[model samples]
Target: MMLTIALPTGRVFSDAVEMIAGAGLPCDGLASPGRKLVIEAGEFRYILAKPSDVPLYVSYGTADLAFAGGDVLLESAMPVVELLDTGAGRCSVVVAGPRSQAERFRGHASELMGLKVATKYPRIADGHFSARGVQVDIIHLHGSIELAPKLGLSDCILDIVQTGSTLRANSLEVLEHVCDVSLRLVASRKSTALRWKEVQSVMNKISSHVKEKRP
Candidate 1:
């Protein structure tokens, strides 16, 4: 029997391939894509999927396993089993804006009021502000969240910070770090029960490879 795995496509795909290769499941076709989404390596079959859709594919059993970001897993709320944290694509979700406004917020005794905040993550933004007793108007944007504060669309922005260069380039200062984000491996519940031995073997291989590569 062949196991079908979904790998996220994009920047993280390279690391996923490295990990998969290190696990002894070298996907040559994926290593050098040629308009192919599906490929075969030994007894395992692989599917390339959008990062956000990987979890959904696995949850519905379209794919037995998937690689996705921890943030996507939390936001999607899919009922997939989180098997491992690959520890790559490290980043932080943060609240940031102009240094002047940030300084004022630090001195303010009252909860932030009547402020419009922009973010790609509405759930995270709502929860973060609510916890601080702040009432905010959330402006959801697909990209360029930093432009919100710069263009006066928002007083603050909630977004992922990888290198802090983008924030600095936009004159935004990080106010607080929300959470650390990383890539994670997830598997379907049915897959786990139906192919326990096979799944364990593959997982063990990948886990051991990860341990060996770590500094």
Candidate 2:
């Protein structure tokens, strides 16, 4: 029986397809043009989902497995087995703002009171700030969080920093690194029991391929 997997529809999709194929699994029909939500590869089937929604698909057993960023999993609070860290799409979650603001944040818990922070990941942002014993107003934006600080819309921004180019271009500097993020293979708990053998085989193949490709 072929397993169903959820593939994220974005820049990482091609690399994900390559990884799946490297693991000796069928990985065709991923390149079909325009809004084709589902496709088949030999006996295997796949559903293309938004990066953020992949966890939801797997959690509800709509898709047996998925590949997505560790950040997404962390923010979604979904219950699933993290089968493997694919190590691609590497980035870091960070707290960043103007250099002058960095000095104020240093050991100054009272200064953070009533400050506005902008981010796409509100949950992650809230947790980070709350842990620091600071009260924050979260401005949730879907894209271009770097603009928040520059526009004076937010005093700081918590976001994924890939190369820090965007931050530097906007005169923002990384204040602190929150967590390292990469693509992860995640599966429903039911998948572990129902498809253990197949899952293990796929993981083993991918693991070997990853080891072989390492420099």
Candidate 3:
């Protein structure tokens, strides 16, 4: 029986492919898939998808397993079995805004009330602000969230920050940290149940490499 794995096709793609290869799995051509979305190597069939779509593919049983970032998983809220922290694509989800808003963000609860926030992660932004008892008007955007505040579209932005370079370039600064994000190995619930033996075998092999990488 062949094992199908979904790998995200962006910043974390190389890391995911490397992890699988290091685990003694065939991952040839994954790093350079070119225009192909599906790749086959030995007993493994790989599905290339957007990071945000990884969970959906796995949960729908289209792929038996996948590697995705914690941020994407949280935003999508798809039900998939999180198997391992692959320790790839490390970053943070944060609340950020213009430097001028920093003091206002820190001092005035009144200012925070019904604040205008822009983000690609609506669910995550809502959850974070709601948990803090702050009401916000969430403006969902596809990209360039950092421009929201400057463009007078939003008071702040909740987004993934890798090195703070983008934020700095946009004259934005992080006001609060939402969560640390990293690539995680996830499996389809049905696949885990029906193909436990094969799934467990792959898990064990990957786990060894994961353990070896840390400390």
Candidate 4:
């Protein structure tokens, strides 16, 4: 019985794999030198995918489980059962902009004059500013949202701030923290029902490992 897990491919991949290994799961495949997107370790088949696609894979039952950031869930809005907060890949969805614009935010309604905001997470950005009763012209970009403010494409950027280095380097400051993000283990409803014991065991191992790392 093989359990397929979707592993995000990128900087977070190594961290996520290490956490899985620490949970007593075989994760040797993650270290193999190859371009292979799929690898087998113990009873699990790990599939490397973009973080955004992990939830889709799990929701569609192509992968039984996955670990993704809470921000991804908010952006993708895929239906998946969140099993645990793995406490890895911590960051925040934040509204940021150039020094002047950041200060103008929420200070006066006058700043709303065709206010521009750039972000890859448009839905998240839209909902955030809307909830605050701030009307903004959200410019959607696939990457380099920080560049938007610097290039004058937008007044600010809504993006994931991991270390705040990107914002600082780009001469931007965080105006508001929309939400905190961390890696979360998710399983499809079908997987939960069909592999109840397996899923439960994996969840327990992961939960215990996370608890052990707590201060």
Every model's Cα RMSD, please?
A: 1.7, 1.5, 1.2, 1.5
- What lDDT tens digits, residue by residue, belong to model 2 across residues 7-119? 89886887688788887787666766367888888877889899999999999988888888888998998998898898888899999999978877885789889988899
Q: How many clashing residue pairs are found in candidate 1?
A: 0
Ordered list by lDDT, greatest first = 3, 4, 2, 1
Cand. 2 Cα-lDDT: 0.86
Q: Which candidate is the best by TM-score?
A: 3
User: What's model 2's TM-score?
Assistant: 0.94
lDDT of each: 0.86, 0.86, 0.91, 0.87
How do all models score by TM-score?
Answer: 0.93, 0.94, 0.96, 0.94
TM-score of 1: 0.93
Give the per-residue lDDT digits (tens) of candidate 4, residues 38-99: 99888989999988899999999998989888888898989999999887889999988888
RMSD of candidate 3 to the truth, in angstroms, is 1.2
What C-alpha lDDT, on a 0 to 100 scale, does residue 167 get in candidate 1? 93
Task: Say which prediction, candidate 2 or candidate 3, comes out ahead on lDDT.
Answer: 3
Name the better of 1 and 4 by lDDT.
4
Model 4 misplacement above 4 A:
none
Candidate 1 residue spans exceeding 4 A from truth: 107-110
